[model samples]
Target: MSARSEPNEPGARAPQSRTGGGGAGARKDPGWWGAPPAGKGGGGAGVPEQKAAGDPRTPKRLPPGGQRGGPPWMGAAMPAEKSMNFGPSARRLLGRLRPHRLQLVTIITLGVSSVAAAVVGPKILGRATDIIFTGVIGHQLPAGSTLDQAVAGARAAGNDNLADMLARMDVVPGVGIDFDALGRVLLLALGLYLAASLLSWWQGWLLNGVVQRTVLRLRADVEDKLNRLPLPYFDRQPRGELLSRVTNDIDNISQTLSQTLSQLLTSVLTVVGVLAMMFWISPVLALVALVAVPLSVIVTRLIAKRSQRRFIAQWRHTGELNGQIEEAYTGHELVKVFGRQREVEAAFAAKNEELFQASFGAQFISGIIMPAMMFVGNLSYVAIAVVGGLRVASGTMSLGDVQAFIQYSRQFTQPLTQVASMANLLQSGVASAERVFAVLDAEEQTPDRVASARVDGRVEFEHVSFRYKPDKPLIDDLSLVAEPGHTVAIVGPTGAGKTTLVNLIMRFYELDAGRITLDRQDISTMTRTELRGRIGMVLQDTWLFGGTIRDNIAYGRPGAGEEEILAAARATFVDRFVRSLPDGYDTVINEEGSNVSAGEKQLITIARAFLAEPSLLILDEATSSVDTRTEVLLQRAMAALRSDRTSFVIAHRLSTIRDADLILMMEHGRIVEQGTHEELLAAGGAYHDLYHSQFTAAASVDAEPEPAAR
Candidate 1:
């Protein structure tokens, strides 16, 4: 029963032209690959210009400071460079943290409390210093000498500066050092310092959790968005670049938040608290320190503006470089087979250089802020010290007050420096957020209908019109029908729309004009899950995930049992070879499935389709990889499979589809002929020419003379 009489010899395949566009190798719509127009989230401000036209080998140009556009595989449509949305993206990034507002407010409160306590500690310690100085001066004076008398004695001794200094010092005439008061002040300062440290630590711990949770939600949203995107969107994007957005870009955002959030809050609060203390202690010195504020702001603004652009370039180049690396690694065998290793290496080097330059520019520019801030801070420090000394000498300020004011000045400048550094992280994080947001904003597939209907294996395409572009019509008014339990065979040359037809039936895309129905129920009325649920498909390219063979087979039917899996495998002859292997069905297949032969891989797919028990079946060049003997067995199994289900088979080989109930000959997305095999040959039409051409070309190749033995 497995050996039916073979029909005419199979046809020799024509050479296929390679193209970068089209889905399933069925169309030649070149416009689909064109670069997206400007202002559509595509190319804009900072992108590098394209290389020479029509030369895929030519490398793209680099922008000033070495930023390269995306790799060619991204089709020039992926956003290489554009106007930055720093303010908007940063706001949106903060919006992602809205759900954790309570935690954030708590963290801010703790930051304020901690900074306030630390700010007071310096003043308390300064008071202790004042107490010790006064005790020393008071101990040296005569027991009954008043402050006026002490000043007179100093003036009489011709030490005018000492008299002026003594006038500023508040010394009781006979009192020595107050160890008790100094100890109390020191203990109070220590307690304040300890409390500030504890509060800051607690705030940091809470901020870490809040930031991690926010990032977790962001990552989840991106994952969901990716799933909702249309197939055409994926076709337009490079896999490596998209992965970078999902993984690398999100990771960068997380790092930025973790490094910046708590520190920025604490620094800002510290600045406010210290500035208040500075003014209270000495308005004159506080005003002097304020002089540096304007200078610091101007320097930070100028550098951050330039570095923001660089950060955007840095992350974009990172994504593009990742894309190129992925493409090279994925096709390494092809590169080796064609001996294009040098070319691949050259492309990688070019992109790596771009990344290096971008990273260098961003880091170098942002790094300048820290040193500039330090210089400004030092200038302010000198001004504050000189003014404080004069105030103390004039008796307008106590020595302790001047000392406290000096400490406040340093505290103030340090936080300003911290804020400036945090700007670097903020810019980098926002740039990454913009990239992640772009994915979330992509156009999604049409929403599925809430209502659904069960399928009965009757499929009809009615007045269907569709195209990948506005001017390029791939399928125009195409119509077909297949009755229940019938085997429909579709044969065509490359780009003749054989695969597109099947894809249409699966609703991988929507029709532009008419409708497709299953058992008289409009397919568009059903949810995609419900519509695709009852259909089983096997394509020419076998896809096996990294799992055991048994698991792969079970993928077709999620809850399929051991008995069902075994029966399906046995029916397709998969069990015969699988049992011969040492581990049998438990043998693990690697990600690429290189451990299995092409023919064996094809059989496993057939077995998977068998296990699905679908009401509708599609096989696109399903038996092309198997040997003649194995092909015969698969045809027999396919026949039994189609006995009670509607089946659509797309094939190049004529011999395998001889027994089909109906044969459709398609060209240019239209069916040119349709009939039974014998009927078509009798008519001597397009089908006859196609059938005989295969037999004749194969026969001629077999008849060629072999080289004679010497």
Candidate 2:
């Protein structure tokens, strides 16, 4: 079959060349949306007129300049544009969270309270320590007082007497009393610790409810969109990739929103509170702690730059790996029959290895941020201790203040590191969001007119043409008609657009050029649901969803009565096989009918179609994979079902199409000849050639006398 030229329509164009050798530009052609420049002579005949000559309305192409190919710091294979802006995704995600604003506010409040309790707990303990060691131990009060009395007196005395006594060598209160203010300090620390723990637990509970519910809703919406999306959208995307977006990508988002959000809040609050307390205690020490900020920031920035790229790579490779594994498993039989196990394994292994490398690199880079921050934190702590100790000794700062400053320094560093770690999780979440949004933002299929009503199964194709890609036209200006209550069998060589013809009839794809009508109404103008409701199709590849036999039979006609399902099954001869099984109608089918034989799957599908009771029935190689006995049974069943309904059948077995009212022979996307079986045989054209190719050998064998009764 010769490839047809891209129809020079207003929007037809070869995709633009990629910008760089690899990375984003290599992965996706930047000019994918740009239309090709129109050629001379208004494009050859059969082309749409608007695109025939260069339309003045088309935008002029800009010359490439500045960071168009690759970044200066990156290798030639990595494009500068590989770094996607997160602004749009962030806005979209944040918008989704608006509905749960109250939940988010509560979560953040709990997180901040938790950080406050954690921070203040140590300060309360330090105060109690100073009261016990200085006020109670210095003997400024009576020597032999009870523990409670001593603690009360020490609390009343305050820090002045202690400082005076230490300066003048005078005695302070409660020197001989045991269990002084230290007990109070311990109690206060315990209370704060408990408060922190409780707040954290509550935060987790609330965040979990919000995140889980949100994710569930989001995933459900995505699934709903999948159902509504045009069937042609699926043709260009892998099932595995789509599955990952729904499952893995959404899960990643949940993790990010739930955990990272809490961490982010806690870290920011802790850092702010700690820095304020540190400056109040000792500005010198606070400065020392603040120095670590720039270093930490630099390290985090570098790691984030590298990690983001790695994350993108990881997700891409993961999608590829999933696609390969899914393809291999789905086509296992074909692989085995062709002895391609080793080749398939090699391809899978290669994709898996790529995924592993990308994942490792991404994780390794992100993993460095925490330890790098910690190193800087440790240095800052040492500097704070040295500077504060000297200041206290030189009488510029009090010992209690110096101690508080040291505690605050640690607090500040802790949160900074925590925030850094949380950033990694946030980035990963953003990466997943990018993928999910890509699906959400894809162009929806054009909607048809709403005025078109239900049809009575009369269909006509007028100069219809279609191409999956601009460079490959599978159907070319093909025209045909199917009247009500007529069986039109389509006979064609492989790749002769047989299946595509049925797809058009179903309006799964929009025609590139031409009009298809049903009962004098354009199919495009009809609602997809209403259009498909009147039609039933049994594909060569039968798919059975996970359910019981009865459930599958009544799938298309939910709420159907048991008698109706049974009658439909009987009509397709599925009842006989189903009855042989232990559970009869209760027999279960796995995904895609993996547990059933091909003939049984086909029969079940036929039963499903029969139950739907459509006005138009399409059988695409319905009995191609069945044995002779099964084929004969199916043939009879199909013949019985065809009466008084418009039907389209695509078949290779000559015996199946013998009684068809009209037969159209197709070759290379065009109808070469058309007539009854007898007329085609008499014409000795393409149809005759195909029939003879199959039946000629059988006829010769029959005429050879069957090996003389051996």
Candidate 3:
């Protein structure tokens, strides 16, 4: 169905109604409509006015069908501030629960059994009371006489009437109780209790298993989805919010489902079973007990509706607060440099307060449900006592029946309150489910049809036009070629689309208007795994896994032997550093190589790349972060690895790429200059200008004499 036709659609396009200010057929007010004043032709008016038929002073609006400032749907949807609720969130939650049908059945069964066992206890006690009072005492009374009269008759006659009556009763003579029958009933109750306990335990065990595994699977699914999601998805969502969906929200589901599913099932079953038994005991008392059910339900529903909205708001604010904190911490260096610590802290405090308010409101409403349910339960208990007592006193009902009814009444109300409490947890689970499903439902990245073949490392970019967003094209109709065994150095100012160029080569983003090929085969036709495996990269920002140095170096090929790892490290001059450490190649590195210097991290990354032994290598600012000495050593290492391989180097330092076979200087997403270093310097174009402007300054600084004389 179309979104506009959906009953609960959160967003819909509505036709705009033109108001009186300035529209077609209205007299054009120059000041109000951006048109010329009546006498002055053009002035401060908001709308353009039509000129007289032959007037030469007015300018034309445009051709008949010209492009407008924005898309037609710009004003179609309402602002997010006006949203009433998280629409479609509940429906998505239900979809997630659909897979757990069998679990649901088990939960329901255990709940029913537990509730039945609970109700049986009170009924058994009531029956025992009846047997003692009515069966034993009433049977001893003489016919057509009260207990008092019978007592008087027994006293006057003096013939053991009470003893005769007791003997006539069902009680066994010369025994304290009916051992066999009582044993059987007691054993039945015991069995019920044991079964209920086991069922409850198993229910918890299974639900926890389901919840943990489900959440684990969900997190994995989300991670996989993120790997396949279009870059645009990340562009629109905060990194921390997305992280929360996979981490915090999934945790919420695990907690709520694991803890509450069994309780909810048990409470619901108890309430139903107890009510049925109450009606069986006495219809009038049952009616009084039931009167509170609807009232409780109505109040619970009202509270739940409000609570759900508040919970959603709370979660959203929590995500926002987490995002802000993460952003502040991640950019702490910048924050400190700018002296914005107080500003960041104040912003955090504001967001935290908003989260606090939302959480307070949600919890407050949910908290009231339990107390309200208990109050209604108390009132029901009072009514049952007053009415049941009167019935017993008037001789219409026996004391035993009244006692049984009172016990059942308590049974009925307690579960109702329990059920109410369980609702809060269920709502939380639903809220989390909504967040999880939102990610799973997002549009996945498009698949490529390319199949890996024997690549000769010859790469081609053919008339390619690309963009991270349609409105902001990054690479515009540019083309290049890298012959096998050639090193192509891409030089550009920051944001000149240098990284984007190589990213396209790896098929991270598909071309908007052209194609990229390896060995004359379309890159898009190759499987992503096969394509990426053939390429090796050493980035400026290196990430090292938590493992031994040998493991990190040999990560690409897990089973690589000691000889291969050492060989790769030796090629990158990393072996010298490793041998110096106490543990040699066995030294453990912390996550992201926090234990090492930036230059060491770069060397490790290069070693990993060398270990891969790929046909194509991409060095993305590999020497940018290192000192001059480390850069020189890396340059020598890269020289040895570059032979017989197609390599693309994105670099800012001109000295590092002077020996490259080809150099392409980029500006504003286009290759404005291309040649060898010598050829580009001779051409005196953009590259020449950049080289003289940046490198010449550096050289002059180096040539400057120290102020030793002074």
- TM-score of predicted structure 1: 0.87
List the lowest-lDDT window of 10 residues for candidate 2: 25-34
**lDDT, candidate 3, 442-461, per-residue tens:** 98767867578977799999
Predicted structure 1: lDDT: 0.76
Ranking of all candidate structures by their lDDT, best first: 1, 2, 3
lDDT of 2 at 678: 98
Q: Global lDDT for candidate 3?
A: 0.66
Residue 8, candidate 1: Cα error in Å is 31
lDDT of each: 0.76, 0.68, 0.66
lDDT of 2 by residue, 577-689 (tens): 89899888998886546667888987988899889888888888888867898889888888878887899998878778999989989877889998899999999988888
Instruction: Flag clash pairs in model 1.
Output: none
Question: Mind giving the per-residue lDDT tens digits that candidate 1 earns over 74-187?
Answer: 222345586688899999998999999899899999888888888898899789989988898899998998998999999999988778888878788888999999999999
List TM-scores for all candidates, in order: 0.87, 0.81, 0.79
Quantify how close model 2 is to the true structure by its C-alpha RMSD in Å: 13.8
Instruction: Give me candidate 3's TM-score against the actual structure.
Output: 0.79
All predictions: root-mean-square deviation over Cα?
10.8, 13.8, 18.1
**Root mean square deviation (Cα) for candidate 3:** 18.1
